[model samples]
Target chain A: MKKAKGSVDEFTQAYMEYYSQVFSSILTKVGNAEDARDLCQEVFLIFFDKFEKIENKRAWLYGTLRNVVYRHYAKKDPGVDIDEVFNDVGLTFTNGFRDTRIIISEALEQIECGEDERTMLDLIATHNFTYGNAAGVLGLTRRQVEYKYGQLVKRILEYLNSKGIKDIAELL
Target chain B: MNTSVEQFHQLLGRYKLSRPVSPGDQEYIINSRKQDLKDLLRKKGKYSLILWIVIAIYAGIRKFGIHITMVQSKIIAGMTAVAVVSGSSTGVYQGTKYVIKAISKPPAKVEEKIDEPDSGMTIPDRRTTEEKTKEEKKKSADIKNQDLDATPLSDVPSL
Candidate 1:
């Protein structure tokens, strides 16, 4: 019983630290707060069940969260394209300056990097991870992370330039 | 216009700010974690039951003296295949139907085409073109033989 309490305490600590980041990641995918919350709950519950076995809790949680999002969309529509789903979420934010959100989201989809690079970008850009922290979570070197970030930014800029948006301030 | 990396990073920061999860949402997720596990287990339980039934049937047929007819055997075999292929505890009813359709259908025929050398266009069946070329060569040879036959003694003197 004491052991059980200890485990619960450990889980709660992890939950408090990573819940918002997990929730935001889900919200980005599902574009619905309620569904994102439900999925976030599911992610943590699974984490709780396998708490003792997890090494690198942040990486495991993010990996599991991504799977949950993929399975949720797959169950919802068996053949849904992920880019299309992201575009739909982008379209939902099309009020005034929110159009910049759509442009940025589209540019992200256009980039040539694989899903891991994009996830790394999300960690640094959305979850506010420092280079060292992001590298720790992603199992990448700091130099590698910086290189990926540079390439991602260059791609986004090139895409925006092609669309005649020369200055990032123009989006603002 | 020179766009600095800092400006791009700031733009991303603003996007993140726009999508913040509310405090109420955070509270709801933390509170409902146990209930979410219960729901997941319930869903998994239904599939587990189906899987157990499939395994029991297979074991019974193989070990016991129980006899199943030809059609029943095919159905059972198909169910087992679907369960294994889907790797799901729940019955893949739709997947089974697709598998049955694929198994029952006849193989499709494919037509092969060849390109004409002069016209640079595709024609059906290279064999037919080969036969046509052979016939043309034979006709040309026959015409040349007829011209040589007509030339006769005069052509012999020139030789």
Candidate 2:
């Protein structure tokens, strides 16, 4: 019993460390604070249930959160369109520098990228994850993540250049 | 910005900073985590109860002088297997029925037409081009009439 309690405490400690990061990630995806909170709770509960079997806790939490968010949207709308969600990714950005941000966001949206690539960008840009860390969370090799991110950046830059915005400083 | 890449990264960093989680939210999540842990433990307790009941039943049977024959043991195993198979089949049947019903149900506020030449195979046209043109023409006529009415008498020619 004492050993069980100790293990529970250890799990709780680890859960607390990533709770905010996980919650924010869900919040960004779902675009609702209340739903994000509920999903975050569900993710941790699942983590607790599978704690013994999970080798990589952070990665598992993230993957589970993704599943939870997908399930939530799927349940809310039976025919949820993923492309519609992707097109509205600009709404997920912060309010500061609204014009430039929207432009950059629209440019990113125009780029034909897979969901995995977009998720990798989110992990690196928003969650501040290192390439290796993002790769673990996304269940990808580090090299794959690096290549995808590089391609995403190149596309965004090309998009900006096509828009006659040669000086990146002008937009900033 | 020296480069677009640097500008992009800087903007993302600023966006990340702008979206910091509040202390209240953190606290709420912690409290919810504790509740979840308690609920998980309760579920574990339920499962442990079943295990304990099985153990107790086995112990009681062992203590009794009643020795089970091989035929009886085989019969019991056969019955258990049959029960499991029947239960799983029933579950699958019910699950498939529910999915089919859900898929067949029509969405709200949309009238389903039953006059198709092919009943089950015909895909309904969501919005016909003829209907769209008609609606557009009606809207344009309404706007033109409204504009004519809004024109002042002074602006009209004395004819």
Candidate 3:
């Protein structure tokens, strides 16, 4: 049998060298640590799946992370200002844990009646895991985390509209 | 832009307040990555070496099975050497041909820039001219009004 050209070890090494960079790339876009970490893992899983087809695995990892983050943002209100949360939370959280916690909390409050939603949101927000990180702890997709967060926001908006609340500040 | 700069600083402050990941966290991540790469390279090299060794062993087994004499073996070895040398020389010749061809070829030509036609004047100049004309018209209108006022009712034409 022909021996494989690249091994699991090689991929792992590449992942290590580039994992932080991938996380950094995702965080820069997603603006949350747990989400960035979750995306980081997803990037590796993608690397493992497409290992044979990829030429430069490191670049592939970064590109995949970037795409996932963009997809997350796109699913949300494209007009939603990421910079607002990022700036408000402050970049001081290099891991972006606090920011992610705060954003998730804000998003969760917007969402309506699902006991599971509150439980999951509490696990992530109060405990301070990123949507991505929470997904890992909860066994979900990074996309799922983003979607849930989005749903929460939508529910909150609906609730507010029903209550005649005017702005995001009202939720606060 | 100024506000973004201020906002960036504020974000940076919040980022610092979060729980620290610690030095060990970073090291663990980095070390695991290094080990993975080293293992991959090592595995690849070992596989390549084994392949070459297996081929050599197989060739030896076939050659001895043929019951070749010393003289025939020597001749075969000499011919193999000649073939290898000739093949290399042929490769060198082809490489040299490409090099020479590349060296002799002229670089691609770049087009010279041609000046474009100017529409009589630019926007700012046109605006200034328009303003100046309006000013001149105003001044003339003012002089006509002054004349009308200065000339008495005697100078005015009868109905």
Top-DockQ candidate index: 1
Please give, for residues B1-159, the per-residue lDDT of candidate 3 as tens digits.
Answer: 333323322332343422223334333333343333344435445324433333233334322333222234345666766899999999999999999999999998999999876888565554577889999999999999999999778776789
Give per-residue lDDT, candidate 3, residue A138. 33
lDDT of candidate 1 over B1-159, digit per residue (tens): 124556777776666433433445444543454344345445434224443344345334522333333234446867778878777634577778889999999999898888648776666765677899999999999999999989757545552
DockQ of candidate 3 relative to the true structure: 0.02
User: For residues B33-100, could you state the per-residue lDDT of candidate 2 as single tens digits?
Assistant: 43444455465552244333332333233224233332343455567668999999999999999999
Write down the TM-score for model 1. 0.36
Candidate 3 residue-wise lDDT, A11-121, digit = tens: 433443355445544555565656656666666666765776799565566467656665677677777554543344333344536644355334445555453365344
> Can you give the lDDT of residue B104 in candidate 3?
96
Descending-lDDT candidate ranking: 1, 2, 3
Model 2 TM-score on a 0 to 1 scale: 0.34
What ranking of all candidate models by DockQ puts the best one first? Answer: 1, 2, 3
lDDT-wise, the better of 1 and 3 is: 1
Error of 1 at A132 (Å): 1.7
True contacts reproduced, candidate 2: 0.09
Query: Against the true two-chain complex, what DockQ does each candidate achieve?
Result: 0.06, 0.04, 0.02
- Candidate 2 global CA lDDT score: 0.61
Docking class of 3: incorrect
